[model samples]
Target: MHIAYFPELALLFADIRFPQDQSPNNASIHLTWRPPHGEAKELDVPLLPDTTSLERIEVTMHSSPTSAYKMGETHNKWLSTCLGYDTVLAYLGENERPVLMSTHQKSNQPQIQQGGGWLSSITSKLPTSLGTIISGDTEPDDKITFADCAPFLVVNEASLHDVSRRLPESEEMDISKFRPNIIVSGAESCWEEDYWSELQTSSGVKLHLVQNCVRCVSLNIDYATGKPGEGESGKVLKKLQSDRRVDKGSKYSPVFGRYAFLGKGDEGKSLAVGDEVTITKRNAERTTFDWPGISSTPLPTAS
Candidate 1:
């Protein structure tokens, strides 16, 4: 998916027009569909899908020296027609937004991935789309695109295996199902992140284990089938609720991943795969949920 101006979205989400009955943007998305050989019809009254699904699909993006950052008026009209609903697209102009702080580090104008046709050669650079940072800080902080919440989600490979062993349908549990940004493989046991406080890489890049990540219906979507699976009582989610219900606030909303942020003074350092990470800090006192039985223990098998 491509990135859009964050401010424009913030405005749209807060727009009063969306609250009106005729405003046309409903809580549920309406899809116009046609069967293989039967009459065309619409789906349910309220689809209740997440907003990410609405971002227009791009078959392939070719770099153009002059591709407009703001989509033209015709393009906006075309999207409305294609989506079969009244939709509006807007662009956040350069210099329209200010630098902001996240739970950690800073979220400024968008920075982006830089690379060629392959993965191994890729790097990152600040995006020119959002103009220079307006903050007084001499050096710029990290650039972030729009996000639903915090920036990074860390996964322990051992944790996935642990969850599978507890579920009846293990085949459906793939690493991709959780969608983690970083996956560490050598943890001593599963669910250890519930107590991890901070970590550093061999190169001294440090990150703080901020808080628990709450699971939502979004996780139920099967990447393999593109269909959200739900038993009569939601078997997969039930299994999570039964054992992974560490968050007492809402035991129904089980958590499986840890949200992390860049530790202070570690902004310039980057985390690469296989960086020989070490647990720079650990906390034994449980906050939200204890990892089954792991408590106050130093991160084991940390590389």
Candidate 2:
């Protein structure tokens, strides 16, 4: 198999897709690339020059979203050397395999609260609330790309502002770094999401809050330079540990936003900007973590 190095495929491929309604002759792209082979280093060619004359890639993607990528032995070897990393590339001419849906479950443990923000109930117990966690895991029925867990990630606009105000603001600190699929803004929206396990949009779209998105080192990457080691991400995380560590069951892991999935029978509808969105609290509980504002008094921290 053979493939090209496209770092944008992870996030940008959705926009470059060939239209399904009509012939995409004008939408075609003239791609030029430098192959890792002989005298012909760079080549320019028209992608999908025409419907009949176009070179189509077919792949049965069971794991990845697209199968139009391939990797050859020589290309693979060259890529590893040039990039200083080991990688194998392959292109699927057509989708022969399909992605399937998998299930996940939140720990059915006693809930406890850590800090200010949402009403997160936490406890030092194993999960006792075992519910089906339908995630974006690889499977055999649905089509999914290289996404990590779920289809959509939900973020609270108010929460982003809250994190910014609490932490040292840096030029690198932009909401795009979090990359949320849906951004919700309202009074106490972030805290309400912790309880918005299931809710509906004005367009009759339904969403389910599944898991609290755990923070990672990747958050530290400086978006401007595309490099890590910015102390901003670290400082925000420390503040979360100090302020946002609200989940008692999972106190160690700092989370900002929530992960969500689409509701059954609500697929295919478009959720646009400025849509009136409302969330209902199906499961209401209070946080037990000792912090200011919750009790209107400061609690002692363990050394």
Candidate 3:
């Protein structure tokens, strides 16, 4: 319903792996804050301090910011970012600065060509008759925190179970692809970006609603189980497009808005949970709302 907090530090990490053989004991993910509602920090470390105890650090997701627009699989998975548990433990102790890593794979992570890079190649696959493809604008400062991004928003236990049953036989739910930042309870029909657009933090940072996020087939891939197949999440979105809302051609309709950037965060620049928000209809003002499946022309705005 509201913006929670502005990220003091954002970290982008790649090539993450956790051994399935053991339960996380020394190092794990946890949210910690000072007493009486103090600073919030995610610790990937252990509580007890010992010579071999693990330390914690926050990670900034790379795919969402860099390659999400293009649907490149090379760096899409979380495993691409996180390292072995023991290695993460060692890194925390050694460095206090924000960290970013690319898995040692010889192959390059698939990159999205915004304006100049991969746009032409991606559009080449789509039928030329489909019209022009417009690249959505990117706002650098409008980054979200890990707390805001969670998969539960798109699917939960009950929804997952029902989805599995309703899905065609042999079909699996690749629920991880949506990669929701906030798993909200009782959200309205509007896209999350529309909601985010109307949001303002206590710090007076106006959340800028830049563009409606167009999703790709990646949602068809499951993050946790790493299963590949079309299932619940994609089915639901496809259904939403076909039966009730926009036609299939409206995939890039900007159902959700992207945060363009954040304002200043001073001592008073703090965003908390449960703040007031005003809703602004999405694409409502546009004379023509069309989804350019894929096109070579650069988007109207660059910033």
TM-score, per-candidate, Cα-based: 0.52, 0.55, 0.35
Full-model lDDT, candidate 2: 0.46
Candidate 2 TM-score, true structure as reference: 0.55
State the lDDT of candidate 2 residue by residue for 134-219, as single tens digits: 32322235433333445566777777777777755554346755667677776455555565455456666666665565554445
Output the better candidate (1/2) by TM-score: 2
Residue 301 accuracy (lDDT) in model 3: 54
Best by TM-score: 2
Better of 1 and 2 by lDDT: 2
Identify the candidate with maximal lDDT: 2
Off by over 4 Å in 1: 1-145, 167-172, 230-234, 289-303
Tens-digit lDDT track for model 1 on 1-303? 221211111111111123356433354443333323344444332322233334432221211111113344454564455444554443322212211222332233222222222111101221111122221122234333233233456667778887677656535366655656667667778887766666666665555665566565544543322345554223555677767777653455677777665655554455555556665555554345322222222223547
Give Cα distance to truth, residue 280, candidate 3, Å.
7.3
TM-score of 1: 0.52
Worst lDDT 10-window in candidate 2: 122-131
**Candidate 2 Cα deviation (angstroms), residue 146:** 2.5
Instruction: Order the numbered candidates by TM-score, best leading.
Output: 2, 1, 3
lDDT of 3 by residue, 1-303 (tens): 111111110122122223475333443334232222333333333322243423233443422222111112322222123321212222222222211211011123222211211100010111111111111122222223232321012212223333345566776443333343322223333332332332332334333333333344444433332233344544554543442232222433223223232223322233333332333222232112221222122234546
Cα-lDDT of candidate 3: 0.28
User: What is the C-alpha RMSD, rounded to one decimal, of candidate 3?
Assistant: 17.8
Comparison by TM-score, 2 against 3, better one: 2
- Root mean square deviation (Cα) for candidate 1: 15.9
